[model samples]
Target: MSNNVPTGAEFKEQLRAGAPKMGLFLNSHSPTVAEQLAHSGYDWLLVDTQHGPMDHEKLSNMLCAIASGGAKSMVRVAGYHDRGGIQQALDLGADGVLVPYINTAEEARQAVSCTRYPTAGTRSVYFPQRSMNKAGLLGYAGNANKNVIVALQVETAACIENMAEIAAVPGVDMLFLGQNDLCMSMGLYEKYEFPHMYTSPELQAATETLISEARKNNVILGLFLFGTTRVAEFLAKGFSFISVGNDLHHVLTQSAAYVQDLEKIAATEGKLWTRRPTALF
Candidate 1:
């Protein structure tokens, strides 16, 4: 019930306590989608600029939309080398960042340092930026370092090999698993049948080992899925923070279901399904 004012630190606390934290992934650069999902009971929403066509201008708008609806915005920048995009995302008021393709502990260290101030990190300071304008310079600078979350995606064999060091990087809050990338990295792209992503025993062994390493460090572990049904599996595997699904997938699923219902209605009523408003008080 603590809305708008909660810090990413608090979110991490919940995660550390094994509490379930739910969020939706948004690839559409539309502020409308951000606004709607923000108020739709999601604890957090990620605007993925990494793989999406979202620009800074649109990202700012989307952040505003998320703010208006009182949901935390976690922006996924392309990569840690994407310093400009990362800075802009933080400037545009992202509550956190999901950095991708981090394959080494040094890279993870660099990514964490990028989010801090001088002596702590190399993040340049500028007052009255987009993220700072709402709260003024005093509060913004005071909280930026404490409030922003930095989650790294571990999707490579090298990353899994260095998972322990990666997890121990100071200020690196969480480590997320990218299913598609992990599968592809293991040379098993397009092979999702029966849950064994790669036939390579090494990949499976590495993934399991990495998960164990994450647990040992007391760092937050993240898992991504196309839907919530798989959450039980992740949860059982000791994952606390899981991204179950996203807007695009939700839209497709709903659209397909609607089409199927329409066909059923047409057969039963001998006509197309008609739209109607009804109250169910």
Candidate 2:
């Protein structure tokens, strides 16, 4: 990594300054894909461990690949309470963590604690680890507490009710709104169609509450917008940390579209062939 690349601390400072940072969620478990996207100008890349198929070895390789491109890397651990998983990600050189299902202030605090060392928190230390190698032993140990970001996911009705307290929790850097899960938790998923989910009065009110609380607490507001269509609208509404979409979604969508276009051209040329099933293997 180049020395000129901004550190995670600097990235957090950017968020504090209200600069919008766009990122991509990496679920393909391919270091080549990760490195490619990292170099493609995203501010950051998140390795999805919760729903993605990556184990510890794959996660470490992905983080290393992300670093080579100078983009900050974060890991979405399997659960809010997965302390060991959180430690592993940071140990493997992740810039921070995005914890899911953090519904209360205490849960947020626990998530933050897992990123720090003793006195500040209870994260266990391992010498000569990837983080130590990247940041230097003493430098990483002494400053990891301040540099490591702790972003909590607010995806439930309980989280919305405790938004103020959760936002005010010490060491909480960013609060990410998980839109689909929030809508499902609030019963708006079944009540509204896909297009209506974002505009539904109930979801909008909750989003407003989160924005207000984040501003009041001086924390960065984040969201998983799914794609680029609504990014401008949300950024204007006060979300600085936003993920446009994931790797798998982009690959699938673009590939399918290309194939469809080819089929249409073939049909127009009277060269279209009948579809046939292929062996799975």
Candidate 3:
């Protein structure tokens, strides 16, 4: 684990100062796929364990794949109670961790502690378990206390209600807004075509409060958007860290649009139907 490289926490400090922090989410388990994503100009890459079938072995492999392209690697554990996933992710060399469905300050506190060392927090340690080189492990633990980035996802209406306390948590690096779920929680399911959730007066006010409190407490603000165009709005709103899209959605969108365009072309060209072999994963 002793690659002796700069940690994401260090990079975050620099990114928070007007430089945009952009990252991608990995839904696939292929190491080569993860490596390709890392080289795609993403500042960081996060493996999604919440929805992906990523075991410790596969995760460790993918982490190495992500680092191969020099991208900061992160993992989104199932939740705070998934200590196995959390600890394994850190030991596997994730630069940071993202905990989802966080609705309370107490949960935020717990998530933060899970990533830290014994004295500062309670993360189990074992070298050579995942991070291949003992050098990488030693370096990771030596700086883990000051280097691990803990980002808590603030999505629920209740989370918005408790934003101040969540933002005030000492070790919390960023308060990430999960807009898709947040919109659903706010009774606006699948409403991206309508008013932007981040721009709504109510959500905007709550976000502003969270950002102000986070800044006051020396924490950073983050926002996740399903649309790339939404990045500009978040940037204008003073968000430094952002996640735009994921592999599955990107692939599905492009495939769907291409098929639709081909179908229209066939209809106009007098082709009664199109035929192709179907492959299912």
Number of the top-ranking candidate, with lDDT as the measure: 2
lDDT of 1 by residue, 1-281 (tens): 25455676787888878887788899988999889998898778899998777899999999999988887789888888878888888988898899999999889988887787767788888977887786788778777787788899988877887888888888887888887787777666554553677445755687687788877778787877887777887787777777778888788777777867877888798776754542411
- Sorting all predicted structures by lDDT, with the top scorer first, yields 2, 1, 3
For 12-45, candidate 2 gives per-residue lDDT tens digits of 9888897988899999889999999989999899
Locate the minimum summed-lDDT window of 10 residues in model 1: 272-281
The number of clashing residue pairs in each candidate reads 0, 0, 7
Tens-digit lDDT string for candidate 3 (1-281) = 23544566567676567678788788887788898888888888889999888888899999999988888888999997778888888878788899999888899889988988888888888867654364466775777777788888877888888888888887888888887678778766555457665567666676777778777877777877765887887888778888887777667767867877887898999986553555621
Report the alpha-carbon TM-score of model 1 versus the true structure. Answer: 0.89
Each prediction's Cα lDDT score? 0.81, 0.89, 0.79
lDDT pick, better of 1 and 2? 2
Which should have the higher TM-score, number 1 or number 2?
A: 2
Candidate closer to the true structure by TM-score (higher is better), 1 or 3: 1
Worst 10 residues of 3 by lDDT: 272-281
Q: Would you give me the overall lDDT of model 3?
A: 0.79
The collision pairs in model 3 are 1-133, 1-135, 1-136, 1-137, 2-135, 2-136, 2-137
Name the candidate that leads on TM-score: 2
